[model samples]
Target: MDSSAKPILVTGGTGYVGGRLIPRLLAGGHRVRALARSPERLHCRPWGGHARLEIAAGDALDRDAFVRAARGCGAAYYLIHSMNAHKGRFADADRRAADNMVAAARQNHLSRIIYLGGLGQQNHEALSHHLKSRHEVERILQAGPAPVTNLRAAMILGSGSASFEMLRYLVDRLPVMITPRWVRTPCQPIAIGNVLDYLQGCLGVDQTVGQTFDIGGPDILTYRDLIHMYAREAGLRQRLIIPVPVLTPWLSAKWVHLVTPVPASIAQPLAEGLSIPVVCRDHRIRNLVPVTIMDARQTIRNALARIRQEQVDTCWFDGGGSLPPEWTTCGDADYAGGTVLGGAHRIVLEGDARLVWSTVRTIGGKNGWYFAQSLWRLRGLLDRMVGGPGLRRGRRHPSDLRVGDGLDFWRVIALDPPKRLLLLAEMKTPGDALLEFMISPQGTDKVELKMISRFLPRGLAGILYWYALLPTHRWLFEGMLRAVARKTGLPVTHGPEKAAMTSALECRL
Candidate 1:
């Protein structure tokens, strides 16, 4: 069978790299099957409905599911990693996932497996656990009967990438900083475009199969160099950075966690990996797959431009369990299941539903949360202190939002323009939560807008957490409703009445 005719299976199709790569593959006339744990996340992608692209809902760790997704695929891109796993079990999770993929590939007789791995010396005693896990996954894939093409890369710089976001927030938020010695360590960073080109190029070049290549940008520099370059690109004043030997990687990770949207779980491994020099040792892949490699300065410049334009295609926070809570969709008695606590506030305004929705969708990000922005910031700060993605993961676009896009700390689980927008809370909480806004026609020139907050408590703490904030939540919701009406240039015709909890259940449909 012709390779081009067979579909290419992408394991992390909902991830930062995989999300961007799938579109390229489709554009290149290759059939793509994107394997995602939560297929709904992929459904919101721009290319989700492409005729040549298929979404496989499955987990890589599940061998049977992996095999099912791999069947009939000419090759597979093994871009899965478990860096966001709870505690330090990411290594074990990654190992198990790789083993599952290997078995699946062997069973399905896959032609090749292309893996993107971190760049680091295997024998380096100071190698971080993150890079070690990546190296281990590479070995496991290569050990399979199917040929493996491994592309090892250092930091990837682009809009919405984890590394770029960390660097961006740190430099933007801090004018003067205390830094770790790793800031001076030499490193080679690659632009996301170059990385994608190399990834797709390998599929055409048969020589790339069964070979390992080190991929990097044109220039090699230190973290300090990246910081200053980022500031220069963003038009910020020169940053003052002080390198200190006393700060360990763990401490550095904690600092990054507080300063940036990247959590400590993901930041720690990255910080540790930066401690080791990561310059490319081999450039054989460069000759096999020629691409105009971008330097760090140009890459940073491009990223800032994208951010300003609000045109980020995919974000580092894109990958995660974004499935709506089962109770959210279940149509049962409000108290039938576990305790679900919620309050709904509705406002009758004299305007078209479209006008109200236009204002509603613009909530969050730099536009602010309408009312009590300082309170929102305080909540975000508290959430960040607990290792959650605060409000830093802003909305992808200013006025438009699709399902699965990150809006501040909330993920858009459901979006129906000019009608309904439901957001699932990503902030640290005692239990699962959802914030939804619904717009409905009230009368001739009137629209009713409802803001609902629901929480399915975990236990006693969850109950306490809800009641304690009951007063504040009411004020916030009512104020936000009035503010939205004002912003829409619509006069409030009636009450900002407190609706029954049962009204929250109406969102199930």
Candidate 2:
């Protein structure tokens, strides 16, 4: 079979880099197979239904599933990473995942594996666990039977990236910032566009096969320099930065957690990585791929423009487990084991389902929750203090939603247009929680809108937490339903009545 004829397999199809790469490959006329844990999450991507693209449901850690997905592919892009896992366990997960990839590559007879790795000296004493794990994965892949192409990069600067977001939030929110010594460490940052170009370029260039290359932009600047550049690009005044040697990476991460949408779990590793200089040691790939490199200023400008225009293709938050909790779909209420506590409020609005649905879809983000604006802000602040996502992440699109898109601190788990939208809370809570909205058409012109909030408690604390907030929850739900009706420009015909959890479950059925 011709090498180009066989589909190219991409491992982290739903990730920040992988998500953007798939569309580019398809545009290049390559047959592409995207491997993801939840195939449903890929269904809403712009290129999700492309004629040349195929999505295979699998996890990189699952050897059997990985092998099955790689069976017929000629070459694979190893974009998978374990940074989203628990702090100390991510390194272990990355090791196991790389082992699985090596076995799968050998068993499936793949010709090449292209991996994107972090940039840092392998033997550097200051190297963080994240960089070490990346280096370890590169070694594991190179030891396999198939040839591997490793492209090492430092911080990626683009809209919707974790690094960019952290930079953006910090600079935008704080005019005067207390700092860490790592802020002065020199580093090279690459734009997402150039990274994608190099990735695609490697596929067709035989010279790139079985080779390792360091890739970065033209400028090598410190974090402080990047921050100043970002402020200039965003039309903001110069920031007052106080660099202190006493602030450890852990403390820096905690500070980032409170100031930005990035949680401590992700910020900590990133913070530790900055302590080491990550300038590119090899420039061989630059000539091999020969693409225009964007400087820090231009990169920040482009990212800001994308954000303002709401054209961010993928986000760092998009990379996580999006599968709905088991209790959400269980047939019986008792099947959830313990009592499932919930509150449901319904209102009959005098409008077509489409009109009501239009208002429902625009619930979060700048639109703001229909009622209790102050309360929402307070909750977001509290969530941030506890290392949660808070409401700062916001939604990808103003009025459109996909299964994996982040809406404030809630993730869209199930979305059905003109009918139902289910969101799972990513905020710190004692129990698992879900907020669901169902719109059912009435006799003729009217539609019944129902809002349900469910909580599967963890233990005694969870139960106490639910009861304490039950009154507030009821008020918020009722007010939100009424507000939605008012926004739809429709008269409320029936009561903003409280319903049972059973009714909410029945509506799903």
Q: Give me the displacement of residue 298 in model 1, in angstroms.
A: 0.9
Stretches off by above 4 angstroms in model 2 are 330-333, 503-509
lDDT of 2: 0.89
Residue 3 C-alpha lDDT in model 2: 72
Candidate 2 has its poorest 10 consecutive residues by lDDT at 500-509
How far does residue 267 in candidate 2 sit from its true spot (Å)? Answer: 1.3
Steric clash pairs (candidate 2): none
Query: Each model's TM-score, in the order given?
Result: 0.96, 0.97
Candidate 1 residue-wise lDDT, 1-509, digit = tens: 87669999999988899999999999999999988887878887778899998889788888899999998999999999877634568888899999999998899898999999999899999998889999999998888999999999999999999999999999999999899999999999999999999999999999998999999999999999999888888889999999998999888989988888788888888888899999999999989999998899989999999988889998888886467877776566677658788889999998799888888889999898999889999999889888788887677789878777788889888877789999999899998999999899987889999998889998999999989999888788999988887788888998788976664366443
- The prediction achieving the highest TM-score against the true structure is 2
> lDDT of all the models against the reference?
0.88, 0.89
List of clashing residue pairs for candidate 1: none
